[model samples]
Target: MITSISTQIQLAARPVGWPRPNDFATVQIELGELAPGQIRVVNEFISVDPYMRGRMSAAKSYSAPFGLGETMTGGAIGRVVESASDAFPVGSVVLHQFGWRDVVQEDAAGFKVVPEIPGAPLSLYLGILGMTGLTGYVGLTAVANMVPGDTVFISGAAGAVGTAAGQIARLLGAGRVIGSAGTDEKVALLTEKYGYDAAFNYKSGPVREQLAAAAPEGIDVFFDNVGGEHLEAALDVFNPGGRAALCGAIAGYNSTERKVGPDNMVNMITRGLSLKGFTLGSYLDLAPEFNEHMTAWFTAGKIAYDETVVDGIGNAVDALLSMMQGANTGKMVVRTAVMADVIR
Candidate 1:
């Protein structure tokens, strides 16, 4: 029988810098009777992303800040177990944005029905087939305007969007692909698993020197996931007419002090480089194009990806912190319950 309560992780307090356990509170709420056009869903998988950190801050950003004492929201995929809406039937698989909870009751409009593929897991909706993959495709194709034969460099190349960016760059016909990771293992995975032509551990040496050695001829495109030093290095090696997609700056997300930017501002003018920072919210119009290409690529076995899964809703906060600390290989997802049990 379906439970009559919902468990949620709420924001208890905003972090000063790095988030702490006391910053969140786990609470349970009594489930109310479903209203017309509403559905009850049991989340199967929840996504933990770096972007959420920015939302935790009270300062304004592209998205609004999460209200303290309220349930934190993010991407989640669930199975509708009870429904009062004709559009969403019981047993329907759906994806929604009401997350940080194990079960949710919301208007059906909050949910979107997802196709049930025979072999693929629903978790794909939160990763490669989802927004993360779209972010990568958008960065390379639209933001950077990459063309065939361009040499591309990606920072934070082992994480979700980074891994996707590396594969998407190659798929988009980049002549050479290079990546920067925090660890040697991650660097190795970039070259071996993600098909990066060359990869370096930023911790091993200065990024500019390592990148210069990797691509002696210089890069035509850069996908900046880790800003600060990575951005500085990218600026140093960009060829004339190079383009860059400034995706995120995980390096400074939790800093209590002001983070210094790259020192090479003159490179932009001298190299005639174009750099643009983008948020995925502005590019939903490209969803059809992203889905069409990524689906075909995944179906054809041309793209490679990974996920670091943390089990249980109770561990969601830890999963988020682990991901921010670079413990995750690709997408960091939380599996709420046994997949078969939830579906059956």
Candidate 2:
């Protein structure tokens, strides 16, 4: 037996406005023995995202919703400890969708083998060089059609994808990068650390006012995360022929009730604005290209990334909940020592 210590977070109840203790259950599971074509992955870190909240609900959407009394699913990074296939070795690092579990046994077909980096941290592959980075790249380049000399604005500016979006836009020769974040601290980090030209706190007042103050002339590209009011606000201040990349709406994820369409959506027609929503899964083809650009940016120190890593895989549930609530400063991740414990 591998004796892997697997901590699984399960759905206890469907939450309404916020995920309470009743909505989550952290339990231990015994990982099954490895077999041919199967690899035993000792999970190291897991990503906590706002979109997972939509999956927890029974509502119809693109992805299948998470069922009641089942293990909550999300993305994670792991190491191969025992492999049954010739293609996979015992020490290969990989990224997979195994949720919050500390250990997993799976076939080698679906996993992305992480390449080794000489000067960078391995955990960075889970952030800047990973899916979130690709999401930002594709959303900015393909979805928003961002161009040089275009002024850009981003919502949820302090979070994972937003950080990458702003920096990537700068790398693309954006004229100005403006962002809105939940707290003053995050707003400061956007302008101070991430090279955003202007940043404001959306929580302080109406998003429209904050954005107007940040980009007085008008925004050319809007990378939206907190939809609803922020979407409405973006529509109001966007220039003619402006582009809006609709990413996750972390603002409305906790609400069980349906939100009314933004009142300012009509402005899209009048102003000739384009609002395009896309998930990272929609642009898988660009992953390799994104990695090349991102690695170069990181090497040149032209782009910097941030992350908020919570200790212990057991805290994955809480970390995910916190991420949805805007508690994390950057990419929210849960780190685990379960592989070491299992090897011991």
lDDT of 2 at 339: 55
The alpha-carbon lDDT assigned to residue 143 of candidate 2 equals 95
Cα lDDT of model 2 overall? 0.84
Residue 110 error for model 2, in Å? 2.7
When summed lDDT is taken over every stretch of 10 residues in candidate 2, the lowest stretch is 335-344
TM per candidate comes to 0.97, 0.95
Which candidate comes out best when scored by TM-score? 1
Error of 2 at 151 (Å): 0.5
Candidate 2 per-residue C-alpha lDDT over 1-344 given as tens digits, one digit per residue, 9 for 90 to 100: 24465668888887877878788888887767777799888888888888888887788987998878888877888888889887779888888887777777878886778876667766667777787888889999999999999999999989989998999999999998999998999998998999999998988998878788878889999998888888888888899999999998887787768887788778888989898999887788998889889878887878787889888876777788788879988788888765556543
Error of 2 at 233 (Å): 1.6
What is every candidate's alpha-carbon RMSD to the true fold? 1.2, 1.9
